[model samples]
Target: NREPQLELLKNFQKELTNYKENLEKVEDVDSYKKDVSFPKICKTNDDKRKHLAELFEKELRDKFREHSPTKTIYTRTNQI
Candidate 1:
């Protein structure tokens, strides 16, 4: 029915909006990475562990964002 279809469209719009908001939050991650220091030359074990943690967190944030479903949908759609 039209009513059900309309409800579905509304929910889709809401999801799209949420995705856009998430995109905004992640947009600065690239610049943040550029300015971040990597402990590549750390001498101590503790320093090495800390650098590894930073690297892991950085990679996790950037890589996890690559699988955004909304982004995939946007990429696949053909706009007129």
Candidate 2:
């Protein structure tokens, strides 16, 4: 119970830090979109959102898919 939750927390923090770092790199605001540069801020934010979704898929969603819904373990008890 705590183990998986703790692991998830760690993974989330790591991914969030990575995401923030990537965001910093793209903060110049003039490079995210060329022809769409008029939508500069929006484009950068959209890119951040997309990248965050990928991180969710890679870090959380993939693991979430492994356990069978009918056989999920809750609490520290194995019987449930």
Candidate 3:
């Protein structure tokens, strides 16, 4: 019946609230920040885009290296 569905919904809401509270109680640290070093000369939008692209490429290369240590990775250098 609908009564069981309502009870399940209530339980789900309670669990979600508890999860949110637990997340809130966690310390706000910089542990989640990536260790990628960004350039200081990102004054223009193009520069920012290039910096982000570099970060993404670096992350992908790192992941590839982590999964397959023997594989050779070739990165193309941009003219910018």
Best candidate, TM-score: 3
lDDT by residue for model 1 (1-80), tens: 35654565565556555644454455334343465555557655445445545565555444433544354554556352
The global C-alpha lDDT for each of the candidates, from Candidate 1 onward, is 0.50, 0.53, 0.49
Per residue, candidate 3 scores C-alpha lDDT tens digits across 14-61 of: 655564444444453123225644477866545544555555456555
Give lDDT: candidate 3, residue 30: 25
Cα RMSD, each candidate = 13.4, 8.4, 15.3
- Collision pairs in model 3: none
* Model 1 lDDT, full chain set: 0.50
- Pick the lDDT winner: 2
Candidate 2: list runs displaced more than 4 Å.
28-80
Compute each candidate's TM-score over C-alphas.
0.34, 0.37, 0.39
Task: Please report the TM-score between candidate 1 and the true structure.
Answer: 0.34
The residue-level lDDT of candidate 2 at 18 comes to 79
